[model samples]
Target: MQVLIANHGAYLSGIATTLWLCLYSGVLTLVVGTVIAGFRVSPLTPLRAFGTAWVTVFRNCPLVVVLFFMAFALPVLGLNASYFVFGTVGLALYTSAFVCEAIRSGINSVPAGQAEAARSIGLGFTQTLGLVILPQAVRSIIPPLGSVLIAMIKNSAIAGAFGVGGDLYMTGTRLSSAQGEAVVPVLIGVALGYLVITIPAGLLLGYVERKVAIAR
Candidate 1:
């Protein structure tokens, strides 16, 4: 398309930035979500409440508001960072609640018998999760985590609207504005760019899911 050929450079940069956003946000979400999921699954009442509060608050809040706070409000509290950092952190925080829930669901999907059996073997709660529940939870965890990563790619576009530079959605919007009547092409380019990441991720995770599926 003329729009793409004329602005391939912008598209390339946008695609790269989108990928970068997905990378850092996805990794941080997984790590923090695991901890929160652990908390949700913990035997301690306080820990469970803390995890519940975290997911309830963040999950209910709109992501753009969270990003705006991270970018604008954090400076007043002396927690300033670059736009990329703020954007990545906001995306991670917003997405992690869902990740925590997904992982918690996987943890729940693990049979009650496993925990009881672990207890019968005298294993403590933490040990039982690390040794028994989580490892087996891996089968269910993969599919949801893949979905999270895909969602992150789409959500990362929000960063550009907030003035995070080099974002694909921003690039497409800018090109659309410049090209006058080619808005459709610009948007299609963005969609294809997103699919570039999500499609492969879906395939890989599907393969992994098939490979690790437990006979149930």
Candidate 2:
């Protein structure tokens, strides 16, 4: 209680930083993941293999390792950036693999006939995916996408440990240690900060799911 009161400003800053990370990373994840999902489902063998390899590697690799590579290794390779950039990029790339799978699963849930019909009407692969298949596939995509986003929110905490400052995890733990406060309360506050983002997201997902179901 005292800890929170004393550090409310820090906590707020942390939350804002976390949100910034989430916003950028989430956008990147969706964009890259969607493109990769297209690759996974593409008619071209090379595209499919490349997509498969992407998912296999990133999905299997630990998040910390990815962050480590992004944070430490990239600068050595001439890509100098802030810790925030590295963290955001790492989070996005790692999460994108899961997003790709979710989208692929949704795409696969769509019937083959839909693609065939679209092709018969002279739709190219891109047109078929965008105009015909994806609209139908969206219903199945939501639940998994929601789950993945929630997981991503949780995963963002790991970024703090890797020198991404001003995030909730870093703020809470650093303040607690510096002040010699109880770790539990500080952590609880951190958890609540996360809930501030996630609970609303869950509710939003629920609302969307209901609307999608009704539309179906």
The sequence of per-residue lDDT tens digits that candidate 1 reaches over residues 1-216 is 877788889888988988888889989999999999999999899999999999999999999999989999999999977899999999999999999998999999999999999999999999999899999898888888878877877889887678777878888878877657388888888888888878987898888788887544
lDDT of prediction 1: 0.88
- Structural similarity to truth (TM-score) of each candidate: 0.92, 0.97
Model 2 ranges off by over 4 Å:
none
What does the lDDT come to for candidate 2? 0.94
Please list the C-alpha lDDT of all candidates, in the order they appear.
0.88, 0.94
Model 1 misses residue 86 by how many Å?
A: 0.5
Model 2 C-alpha RMSD vs. true structure (Å) is 1.0
The worst-scoring run of ten residues by lDDT in candidate 2 lies at: 172-181
User: Which residue pairs collide, candidate 2?
Assistant: none
Report the alpha-carbon TM-score of model 2 versus the true structure.
0.97
Q: Pick the candidate with the highest lDDT.
A: 2
